[model samples]
Target chain A: MNEPTRPLPRANELDTQEFWAATKNKELRYQQCDGCNTVVFYPRRHCTGCTSGNLTWKLSKGFGTVYTFSVVRQSYHPFFRGKVPYAVAWIELEEGPRILSNVIDVDDPLVDVQISMKVELVWEEHEEINIPLFKPVD
Target chain B: MKQRDAAIVGIHEYQSRDVEGKVSALQIKAESAARALEDAGLSWSDVDAIYDAGDGGGMNGLTIAEYFGLKPTVIDTTNVGGSSYEFHAAHAKRDIASGKANAALLTYGSTAHSNARAIGVGGAGGAGRHPADNMDVFSGMTLVANYAMVAHRHMHDYGTTSEQLAEISIATRCHAMRNPDAVRAMEDLEFLDIRETTIDDVTNSRMIADPLHLLECCMISDGGGAVVIASPEVAKNCRKTPVWVLGSGEATKYPQAGGDITASAGAYSGAQAFGEAGITPAEIDIAMIYDSFSITVMVLLEDLGFCKKGEGGAWVEGGRLRFDRPSDGPALNTDGGGLSSNHPGMRGIFLLIEAARQLRGESCSQVPDAKLAVAHGNGGMLGSRHAAGTIIMGRD
Candidate 1:
């Protein structure tokens, strides 16, 4: 039997296609409402704050802090079952948007990973997209 | 219309968790519906409005109405995760008060455990990808991890400890010991230790995710429940004492780029519920909080105004949540709650059923003179996007 792979985003979503396309070049993109100066992540069409269609895409510096995290001791997904006790967190980016990612390059996730710990972005190159991950800044 | 113009006249919880595929989800729902209507001293024809969460299939209102053979007017198929029933109650209340429907029926059923499904370990699955799923699913975010993140943040922000979170599990287990219908009491499930749980029992349990032990999580049981709401005019002639729907509110919370993970939608929904009830949380005698996880109840306790913000860790420390505990706070989970009793996928309907039971002075672990109750249901994930529904009921 073929090994199950990680869940992938559907190709060519109208709102998020640009985001995935940018990831091909290892660029992390977020949106900022041009009208209200509001930051948006996850690449939405309109501003959540003001519902403004006028938005601008900005590249992230990929420096962030751990807003919150959990050391998942159990997962049933085929791709994740073997990787027990990995850390998943919401990273508070310096550019003012939080993104969900795995905190990689940690010895022990429960002991090393913590809230407010500074981290820098790294990329996990997949066939379709370069998934953004974070590692603790030394 | 007055807030108490609509009342819950009847409620029924399907007690079996070991259906073993002998019964279908729709079958359980139809049975619960018939039993609830019988409890209300009303016939099947008395139900003019039907409300369901569509857990069985898409277009739930039409599907459920057709299955029950009802062709009435109002149909609400609000599926906001688990809190859909509370939202349904709010809509049913409005419909009944406005003369749009005299008697409204809300029903739910799930066979999660019997199907041997992984409740929280598996990430949400769908046929096609959505924009939000693309962003988060790659991280391998399981449902338990989502709530575990919230518990981690709460501990970080307020110095909350694992022992403090364990207190919630211990208290609910105490109530579970008193409930004969709790999952622990199932004779065939002899593998389960039916003894009362201690804080150590909770803390020492295997960790599913960081900051959450296995004992702190709710049981996955195959069960369902039904609720009947009617206008005051119809309530007077019901079989049982009417549990007046004094107030209700529903709201949604999501990650707004970088929202507070510790705060839940309960802050908004609970306030609207209590404000419309014209009473404070202190006036509540029983609190049937959705205990999907121990942290769920702890966070909602603070967000629902039962305690000050960031003070929930200290607040739940004692045995204060027990029905028999002598405290100023409301008795919690008098029917054993989702934590120890029964949680079949969407547990919102059980909250309403248990709250109505307490108000009728019929709970297994009854609180004396329980005149007022609050049933708060949190749907989706607390750490991610979620919905909250709050309902306050009073006995006449």
Candidate 2:
């Protein structure tokens, strides 16, 4: 039997701490600029749109559409050693930002995750953190 | 006061297969630099500025200068991934034109295949404590994967077929057959015997990432490329004919949440370059755009105004980029590009060198009456953000 694969280490910066912490609670959160109503993922303090310092964290509906995807058959990372032929997707959230995620719980990702396929958050528990993955909705 | 004109007076390259043993990056860079100086009919004493792509690694310009034994007054180590050399050329052009430096040396060297660390993920000997580390969330979002995502989106939005992308690889291989310096590692054939592949051959090759087969991606090889940009007065006295740096532009799009992966900074940089050069896209005789992946060429073609945004798939179809294509538009990548030639991690310098060669009427697959050419370099990931650098070179 193969050893369970480990998720790559993530460096949670000060601005993105809330994002990682929210994942631990099985909630998907992103930051929005209070001044210009700009939505941001992979959080930062200032509004990228208007350079406003005021930003607020909002919970997503945990749903999104597949903007694009790739099936990985080759990877240089050791964590992906046994996990070849997996689907990595860029999900376009309803909140107007895109997230880099994987579409999970599928028998064949090639046929399942066509462009614009609806998906919802599916959190995977690692040692100390929860990684938010996506699975087909309906 | 008017700014002085700057021109590329010299260019050189070093390409190899690392099956022998370990070779230092510094040695490759130094040799290439010395050859470029020799080509320019100058010595190390003539160089007054150094520009290098020092991404992740700090102060690469200083290190290279110390190795080459030159004391440059100005140094630029701007690292924007693969496109750093184009940025270097852009910066060096301005420095020479503004009289900040009389001569600028731009060099790049990478032992990507020979060195295990160069080919491995997170393998650099550093503390690995950088802000960019947070961007690599997906273990599969490597360079090839990032390009695959772009191709996937392009197909989804524009109905681009996999066969359309394969045409790029086949067309490039056709040109690579004539380039002696190009490294052919895919098959057991000699570089000259590498036959033109069919769309089926490309589609059937092993897929590294979905929508991107092995054929569509660039080959890794150890290589070095260098260029010498000098004031027009200095160039006039050089040994070889000078290729004038007509215009240059660069723009960066951050890969954070708001950026569109489908879109690129090419549109902005291309517009700036054209505006500065006072030339339209139609005026160019040749194009030497970066091709880390086939999708990269198509996307840049659309973004640079060579075709309508969604028309890139059709624009390059039916052998439009081929030298013998019998089209009025510019011929592209007459040197086979990074896809079929050599990609030593940073490929921007090769684009500039090829463009200069075409402008000088020195390319093996030269475009007929080629006088003006465009070289665009792209760096970083697909969806999040990246840098685009465009340089226009001309011969009058």
Candidate 3:
């Protein structure tokens, strides 16, 4: 039996296509509004701060601190059911935007993950997208 | 145009929590609507405005209106997840006060229990694709995890303990034990241990997500409810005591870049509502908070001004939320709430119903001489983006 693959972004996602494309090159991209100098994450056309349309893309060094995290012990999705006891967190990147990613490469997510812990990004290569994950800084 | 006062003249909650294969969502809506209208001493003819969250089907307001065989002039289908009905009640109050409509009806129903839906455990970024799915869903963010993250952050920030969160579950279960409907609902669920839960029971229950035990989570059930907000003219002729809509407010909150995860939209909506009502949290007699999770109620208690921020864990201690508590704080979830009563996908409508019930001195766990009430609903995920609706009501 084939393993159920995780869902990926559709090709028609025009707003985030560039962000995913950059992820393929092992680069994490976010937008900064030129009008208000506001940082926007998860890729958007307009600035969330000032609603400015003139936004510029910026590359992240992929280093951040864990703002918050939860260890999911159960999941109903076929793809995630097998990956139980995984850590999901909101990482506050040094560049000023927060992104939701998994705290990967941890021996035990429940006992290991801590808030405010420094972490650096790692990419999980997928068929269509390079998933950005993070690990605790040594 | 001069604004008139609006009151909730009728309210009805569908009694059962499991109606799978027995009734459709539309049928539940129609039935609840009829019962609520009848409770108001009115009929479908008196309803000129309709509000729904489209929990039934596409074009929800239209579908519900057509199914009920009504020609409502004003139709609203404002859906902000579980808090949709609170938003509906707020809009209906505005419409009635402005003379845009006379009698406004709000209804909701869902068959999640019968469908065997894993609402909290179901991970995000699945079949329902969105623009942000690729970014957030790949992290395996489940609905329960969203709220759990808030609990985790709360513990990290304020040293909130698992025992403090368990108090909310224990207090709600205490209220549920007195409610026959809640008792029946629990008995129907084979997987649940149908009895009043203790702190140990809540803390010891399986952890669905770290820091949030399974007992802290709201049960999945099939139920619906309806509310009728009418002008004072209509309210005077109604059968029940009028529960006046004193004030209402709605707001949305999300993980805006790096915003504080411990805070919720309730802070804005509650402040707006209490300011409009000319009262403070101390004046509230009953608080019908949406207990989607134990953490939900704890954070909302702080945001709603029942207690100071970071003090909710301490404020909820010592059985303060219990109905029989000697302290003067508001009695919480006197009808068992979503934690113990019935939570069919959307629980906002029931929040309104229970508040109205307590104001009328008809609650299963009645708070004596209850004169004021506040129903605050939190929809969507607390960890991610969500909406909050707060309605302040009074006994007339």
* DockQ of predictions, in order shown: 0.67, 0.47, 0.72
Residue-by-residue lDDT tens digits, candidate 1, B1-396: 147779999899997976888988899999999999999999889999999997767677787899999997999989998999999999999898888999999999888877988978986353145687778867888888999999999999999999999988988888888988884434433426777899999999999998899988887788888999999888999999999998999999988766888899999999999988888998888998999999999999999999988899899877889898735689889888877888888999999999899989898999998888999999989998999999999998
What DockQ was computed for model 3? 0.72
Question: Candidate 3, B329: how far from true, in Å?
Answer: 0.2
Candidates in descending lDDT order:
3, 1, 2
Instruction: State the displacement of the C-alpha of residue B316, model 3, in Å, after optimal TM-score superposition.
Output: 0.3
Candidate ranking (DockQ, best to worst): 3, 1, 2
- For model 2, the stretches where C-alpha displacement exceeds 4 angstroms are A1-4, B1-4, B17-19, B117-132, B183-193, B255-260
Error of 2 at A118 (Å): 0.7
Q: What lDDT tens digits, residue by residue, belong to model 3 across residues B52-140?
A: 89766678777788899999989999989999998999999988878899999998888899999889998864623566665786778
C-alpha-based local distance difference test score of model 1: 0.88
lDDT of 2 by residue, B48-125 (tens): 999887642666667677878999998999988888888898899988877899999988887776664434122112
lDDT of 1 by residue, A40-131 (tens): 77788888779645889999999999999999999888888878889999999999889998998999998999999999999988987888
- The lDDT per prediction is 0.88, 0.78, 0.89
Q: Can you give the lDDT of residue B148 in candidate 3?
A: 94
**Cα deviation of A75, candidate 3, in Å:** 1.0
